[model samples]
Target chain A: MTALLSLAIDITLLSVILAMLLCMIRLLLGPTAQDRVLALDTLWMCAMLLALALGLRFASIIYFEAAMLIALTGFVSTVALTKFLMRGEVIE
Target chain B: MTPELDTLPVWVSLPVTLLLLLGSAIVLIGALGLVKLPHFFQRIHGPAITITLGTGAILVASMIYFSALQSRLVIHEVLITAFIMLTAPVVAMLIMRTAVYRDLRARERGKTPPAVKDGEASEVYPFSTKKSLSAKK
Candidate 1:
């Protein structure tokens, strides 16, 4: 049973990697900067997902902690960039 | 039902396996939407699909599988799911607002409307100032 579950995890991880690749294409070829930002946001989410999936596959808490940190940083950076674009200044 | 059921634990594993497959497929579809959507505001909705359903399903599967394997609550997957749900939409909203602002500024400067915002419903760019954009007499 454990082996089967590991197999399932492997398959899902592969799919997640494929999804991230698709997001990368959008980041590369998006027609507008806004579209690119959208892609980058999605890319970060995918990376977080990938990390969580890794944690499950390996049964490792460390990967989950790393995923949390990545999610936190990604959220802050994306928000800052958007706010900067809105006001023409990142800092008041 | 005794020997097979005891050996396989089919009841528990069945739903977990299906959920894992389904969640991965949904995430892939969301990524497709992100790639294929025509514009920024439209694409902003794509990852939300992953956050709401995709991440939720996978986390649930993780909870079930990990608890079965480890013989404990194994609820840590909830944290990642919650984080994704809380963050994805906020980022999407901000990106949409920024796109709208950029489009308005470009138009005010006499540039052609950026392709993404051309036919979309417009939002007033709140950053506009009367004197800042006007020429001195």
Candidate 2:
């Protein structure tokens, strides 16, 4: 039973990590600014998913808290980018 | 523990695991689309797919598994889900604005957006403004 559970956890973790790696490729190869920003957005979602997986694997709430923080930071960055794009600057 | 997982039945873990895997796969495919999509406009939609469906799946899995394990109603997963739903669109909006800005500037300069906005001011993303045109010049 323990072995099966571990396998499940490992597979989940591997798949999430693989997704993160693919997003990283877009981050590196993006031919345009929008593409890179889009990739960054995906990257944040991937990281959050990873955190949830960790929480499940360890049976800890701390990972979830960390995930929340990551989500917040990602939000702020995206907003800043949008504002900068619209106004020609992110801040005054 | 969120004060809820203690009573979660063991049976819930299997399906939750499956959902998470499925979500991760979707995210992977979205990234691939981001890489392979031809233009900035098409690329914008790719990650949106991940942010919506992909994140939704993982969040559902979290809610289910945690609720089952902790033996209580865990509602905090909703918070993250809400956060992602709110932010992904905003980020995409910014990227689109940047693309549009580049397009307009390109038309002005008599060159394709690729040549004019490649590292120019008009291409500045709506977020940092600091990383845009002035730096390139």
Candidate 3:
């Protein structure tokens, strides 16, 4: 059972990492500012998932805290970035 | 590393494993769509899969694994899941609106239409013809 669980966790970790890499490629290769912003948003989500998977693997609450933090920060950043893209300034 | 799983029986472990795999696969498919889809609007749909179903699956799996292992409720994962669910669509909407705003501005400036398909072009920019006609004057 431990072996099976470990295998599942490892596969999830690998797949999420691959997804992050793909998001990075889109971020780099995106033709428009909106595309780049979308890629960044997806990138942050991938990071959150990666942190969650790590938390599961280690069976630690610290990783959960980190995942929560990532989620909070990622949402704020994406919102700010999208606002900037929309109005050319974030505060307005 | 293995201590957590040692407590879980095959029944519990099997579902957790399947959930994890299914969630990751959905996330990967979403990311793949983001990369392969041509238009920015089309690409926007990709990550919806991750935000809704993928994140839900993984969070549920985590909740189940920890709750089963510790022999108690471990519902904190719900916070992350709820936060994600609340925020993802907002972000997608904001980014999409920004894209539309930019595209309209570009069209107003008489820039050539992007390589969007004909059917989608009309739907995506309803006033495109009128704008182009006005710009020509």
Per-model tally of clashing residue pairs: 0, 19, 0
Give the TM-score of each candidate: 0.82, 0.79, 0.92
Expressed as tens digits, the lDDT of each residue in B1-137 for candidate 3 is 66556878988899999999999999999999999987787789999998889989999999998888888999999999889888877888899888877777776677744635445656655665566557757
- Where does the lowest 10-residue lDDT sum fall in candidate 2 chain A? A1-10
* lDDT per residue (tens digit) for residues A1-92 in model 1: 54555567777899889999998998898877777777787778778778878877766657868888888888998998888778978898
Candidate 3 Cα errors over 4 Å, as ranges: B113-126, B129-137
Q: Candidate 2's residue-wise lDDT over B15-121, tens digit each? A: 77677667767777787787776667667677787889888887888788767666679879899988787777767766776777766565556665562344444
Clashing pairs in 1: none
lDDT of 1 at B57: 80
Judge candidate 2 at residue B72 and give its lDDT.
79
| Local distance difference test scores for all models | 0.75, 0.72, 0.87
Looking at candidate 3, what is the lDDT of residue B56?
A: 93
| Model 1 per-residue lDDT tens digits across residues B6-119 | 233666677777888888888899999888866566676788887688878887887776676666788887777777778877887788778766776776777645553455
Chain A TM-score for each candidate, in the given order? Answer: 0.90, 0.87, 0.96
